[model samples]
Target chain A: MSEPILDRPRPVAARRDAALPEPQAQDPDLELVDRWRDGDESAFASLVRRHHGRTFGLLVRMLGSREEAEDALQETFLNLHRHGHRFRREARFGTFVYRVAMNAALNRRRSLGRRRAQLERLASRQAAGDDLPQSPRGPEAGVVQGELRARVQREIQALSPNLRGPLVLYDLEGLPYGEIARVLELPEGTVKSRIHRARRALRERLIDLVSESDDESEGAGQ
Target chain B: MSLRLGHRRFRDQLSDYADGQLSPRLATRFERHLASCADCRKELGELRRMLELLHDLPAAEPGPGSVDALLRRMAETEARPRRWLSAWGAPVAAAAAGLAALLLVQDVSVSIGLPGSAVRPEARSASLVAAEARALPRRPAPPAPSTAAMLGRRAEFAPATPGAPSGASSSGRSALAACIGSRDTRDCIRYHWMLDLAGRDVPAFLEVFESLPEAARPRLAGDLADLARGSGSATAIADHLRASRDPRAATLAARFAAVGRR
Candidate 1:
């Protein structure tokens, strides 16, 4: 994976302004959006550079697969190009981009689910054996931590998209409840309840996974 | 009034409290409840731990070629408009086929008349001529056309005289007088009738426009040459028709263009 320019210890702030330019950015995103609408191709490239990484991260969290996320990311930018004229100046550009990214990721996941059986059949035909490739990090780097991460990922993926979307946007992306509500087209109360419920559900599963991993570690040591 | 703050209630508050999202009153109440509840305290601690774990989830990074591939795809999409044909192609073709079937089934009458020549020679009044020469966009768009609508019911020039009730006839006559006082009654009445017809039925307006005497077309299409300023679907159709350079059609197009309705 390419290095993310916005990655820092203070990711919340970084994510918020991830679309801004690196040095002396003269124009805001709205200005760039206008220029892009007027057929300024470079303005669009500037927008892509500004938002693609953050958009890519959002797709990965929502879709939970790099290959699918990449496809969704492309679709998201293409849609932005096509429909940028519909952007209302009254709204935040970041919010608009987030809505587009979330929609593209969720839609791709929905279609991907329908195509899974067909994909599996194609995969089996190309596979040399049923055994999968090993992780490059190997099993030495804290087996319990690996299992915990894997289990957490599996549980998150298993979450209904409605609940999972709010959780990812609020917890992982640090978007406020109101913003999540707008992006998800839910009431603020619904977003808040979903976040709370999602946290409780995730905590329960993580707690169970931790206990199970502890028991296994103890058994192995004996 | 005081409300119950039981284990269930406290559990719900724990996540909001961790996020510092609770109102001051609710926070104070929850804190007061937490001061005595050990079970609630333990649950809050677990919830905070989970939040921390979630916050620490690694940010996803895109592969180096991701942006390049996206740009390439966008370029290809820009180069190939044919790809978009699939979006509306089937529906449009089906609608076209259905329209063709309808047209084939119906033996419609084709009228050939001079452009803006709807005025009956005997009924040509000075007030109607005066009303027709007024600038474009005199009134807002009429209601949308429906198949069962009485087309051109308002075509009769009802001159509004003093002491008469402000009915359709009065307004129609008043509109005619407004156009006639500014220009020739012949041109004004023709232009006014054409505008009304365009609003009522585009196909009928186009038929008359196409059949108009070439010599009288330009003189009749006053202010209608610039009818591209209207709103909604009517303006869109007007814009396409105005491109035909038919002077009478342009006059009709201007009428639809003046009204900002669908």
Candidate 2:
């Protein structure tokens, strides 16, 4: 639970960008991709249906808006449908999916238009009198924690996309350094360095949290 | 100074060490450093705590049925023919662009060219200025129908001249679509759509031209190529259209014995 916190039943404020966890040894899902490449369109659909939740969960955190993430999701799979043939099978197909999904999220983010916040949407959801799925300590503690969480999100968003991409992939999505390197077309060492730099920047910005121990906070790591 | 640099290097490895990513030997060395360095221990504890908080953020789920919606869109897109201009090679696209540019220079429909601009906008008669206003794109933005589409739109807004072609109104809509924003193509396309007396009835005249008998394609192609230069013969090319199934082709046949299909 100190790592991936994906076991929630209700909507928690999700992090923005994430990727599917790729197997370090081999890509077992290459057969599914091969089936789609061989004109078994149903395999593609099954992949879309299966992976949509995880890909979208990551993108919403990455793009900072559910609506934009949804659009990015469509672009991701459509790109796969159109150009998945270009996938040389060098990396795990799961890793390839992450690359496409991440690229779509980043490209859509860079596209000349408005940027929206996931927190703003969550606030709207809250305004509708809907309680978030978890984080129930006390109302007073919840509000303060919520403000700190929003600040953390903004600081993460403010990081350069270069630092942000690797950090989100490694820390939030829980992809390994090697898989992240393949997805980002960077050296694994570069990916590790970027993640570390991103972490330091985030830590420096949220340094006040260092004084206040998170170990006592409700489900801080889980 | 050496100890300080060593401490700084250990701090750099702190991220790797906290993630339990370093090799065992490096980890042992880092452990040795951490045993004495209170600063490194405190920093590692803070880093671990921060990393945990980040990991604890909740997940964002997809809206209900987004996958189904995506699949439906995929099916719909597959059903339709692709719309990109990739089919036409660079040469044809270049030719089309050149034709579009040529028509732009001679744009008489909006009177931005010689005959139109001959009279200054300020000095033009009130009635003429009023007529031009309706045709000019001086208002807020419209949709992208693109550069050519905008031109076609402006052409519709243009005031019709006295003694203009007999079927100008009938061809206006088709001309609006076929204009590609060029007055020459608009005039050419509108003229063809105008009469049983002249051009074929295809809205996508270029597409229709592609479908014609190979012998006939070059005949019309020659006319179309020379169209910008104003040297094309519309009369001879109509003879090639006798086999065209369009009802309008009949009028073209009757006129083609005398007129060159320019």
Candidate 3:
């Protein structure tokens, strides 16, 4: 198995802005939502800044394509704008917003069936020729990094929509099972099971990639 | 083996256990089982590794200009003038005047009489008549009854007169009938009554509509569209219509463009 890439330590100093004390008062998101409802247009922009990255990340992982993810993200925000009043603050604003984004992504996937099929076929064809025999990771890990990224992307694309949604939300997005259930409107048990199953399936698919480097090292020594 | 220690049961709870969602008692039992179970241990390890890979995938940001476009759309909608039916039209003017006269006469009759006697018979009669009219099955106009039959019925109650007041105008009845002719009308009426009867029970209405049989869905969709048009709120209706597969309902919903356009 290829050595798992250690996550680069994110700069702690950069997190200072994020760690700054949140207002000791009301929930900022609830306030922003209220402002938007009251027709203060700028309040929505604040919401976008706060959530856009996470929302975009979930979309990308769900779609497995940057362009489509971008489109879905835009639609999600637009939908939020058009239907802001429908939000009742029944749950955390994050959960409510993620649910909306996830639904939008799923709907967009259904609508893009023909295009997606064509793209998948193209992707598979590209994968066949481009599957360079696993390269050894050394001082220059660029090739290994690129190959691993591509493999990850392909495996994500291969997952069924049902499995993919929970996997992306729980695994890629690191959302808790309860929050995922809220977003997907499924029972918490169902969300957890799907995430587990999705993870198992992805590991089985990628085990060869992980093991290839070890096999190569053994052969070289022999 | 304990009843809960079977493989099928374990598999069902495995996801929950992995997610740390299992109740403490069950989790403790499961943890004990996992300590001895090699297969479960390996499975969990593999699953965790996959999750790590998934977590490493980069986040994708939305393309530029999309937010601006959305904002512009919102602005345009906000800036659009609200459309309302003009009250200056002759029919509306006449109707308003008649209603005023009816109310005035009712007030005067109530004021002139003593105590309970002040209750105007006409007003009570009008209400009873309106209730009866509303209760009648919404159907196309039936042929007029023979003069003899009318006279017989009238004689049973009050003396027959050549110019007895009609229960309701034929035109108004026909207009209402036409409105209720389709399944759409029935669904709209059902929703209207549900909403009115409970006051903005939107979730209940949605639940009812969602549970409707496939065969009835198109009609309900049409009814929703009609109601949206009538009420001058088309966004929800349009969203429903867009999600529906029935082309006919979609076409019917398209007619509600005027509601959202303004």
Candidate 4:
């Protein structure tokens, strides 16, 4: 009644040592995977440090809400922990992890439909004369970097999943076309085409933003 | 003059040409075109500039404390003992340990000190042992069939019959295919079928689906559905469903399409 065989404490490190080997000597991901397999608690921690930001950033972009992104990020890591054995070196560790993050974010998006509907209702209410004050542009006012960034983000968000996958992998993650193709399970030609299409779409959306910024700069005589 | 004129076609290859993915001969032709054509040159310049601007987009950074959280999760996962030993580990050592444990358990259970009576003579009989061995046949069992193989076999055996509700036929194969095919019928069929098949052999199906004409989607969907229902093979439905525009029929066809090769 007190304990089950499955719950028996097998030898597992409760903490990772700070003096663990340098990240270079061992492939950090492989090491962490092996350590996790062997019940080294700290190895898992190192892995989280290595990949959390990139994973979080991807979830943020995918979900477009910081709170949702955080939740998705947690879910992604939990999935990784449960499915660590599925990792094989056939794909880059980063690509594999990002794929998991993308999937988790997509799942969250699917589940958030109800919340989206609520938000839409609120948005409709706001449209009917809510007097929310607009925040000023950043310190570099004339540059409109913040505005441009928002425009770019919106344009990217507007892209279809097909185009966005390659676009984000290349532009945000800095993965080469080959890596992007491998990660997305697409042909390199298709990856290139999608990236091109995404770029073209983005350019179309941002033309006004770009021109407006240019006009503003000229008007300011700077 | 014809050769010079034909060189203009190379101008359209600039995107691939720049990446050196183009054939050497075609690349050379494109370069020659680029040298002579001002408009092509300008277009390439614009493309290059646009690409440069895209590259200049800020690199996304990971959120704070996220890495630490990930590591802690990993550590927790690692610390948990696997229910079974992996093939990569020390097999002999594991086997020996397992054998020793088994023997210890047998010894403990059979000990005369236990409250239960010592081994009954009938329990130790050769016939009894043989009967038990026959029932349990402890040699490693054959591997289970993969999900794809099982599904394929099930699909093969299941008679192809229309399962959708009456009105669903109106919205069925042909209509669905028409909707899907109009935008990218081939890709739509491939994607839909792949999803229908739970994402097996996706790339191959995608290629084939993408190559088919949009007008042919409904027919394809109807045939695929029939195939799924095991009423017909892929080849049987190919011709009749090829250009079918009936949504219900197309949906039915797609329902049975070979989503994965297996």
Q: Which candidate number maximizes TM-score? A: 2
What does candidate 4's lDDT look like per residue over A1-222, in tens digits? 111111222211111112222223344477666765564434554566677887777776665567777778878876776676688777656667887887887787667677785774465335322321132222244545554454445556656667777777765665666667667778988988787777667655444333223343333222
Grade the docking of candidate 1. incorrect
The model with the greater lDDT, 3 or 4, is 3
* Candidate 4 local lDDT, B28-129, one digit each (tens): 556655555644554454444444445555655655544543443232232222332231122212222222222222332233232332332211221222
Q: Write the per-residue lDDT of candidate 3 for residues B25-78, one digit (tens) a residue.
A: 786666665555544544554454555555566666666644443333232222
Q: Each prediction's Cα lDDT score? A: 0.53, 0.54, 0.51, 0.46
Worst 10 residues of 2 chain B by lDDT: B120-129
DockQ, each predicted model: 0.15, 0.13, 0.14, 0.08
lDDT string for model 3 (A1-222, tens) is 111112212332224325322223245588877765554446666687678777877888787777787778777876776565667655667777898899888898789778777888687557734763444222144446566677787877777789988887765666666667778889988886787777767777666443335444443223
* Residue B212 in model 2: lDDT: 47
True contacts kept of 4: 0.17
Q: Give the 10-residue window scoring lowest on summed lDDT in candidate 1 chain B.
A: B103-112
Model 2 docking grade:
incorrect
For every candidate, the chain B TM-score is: 0.28, 0.31, 0.26, 0.24
How far off is residue B49 in model 2, in Å? 2.0
- Model 4 clash count equals 36
lDDT (10s digit) by residue, model 2, range B182-235: 545333532332221123223334343343455654455543433311322334
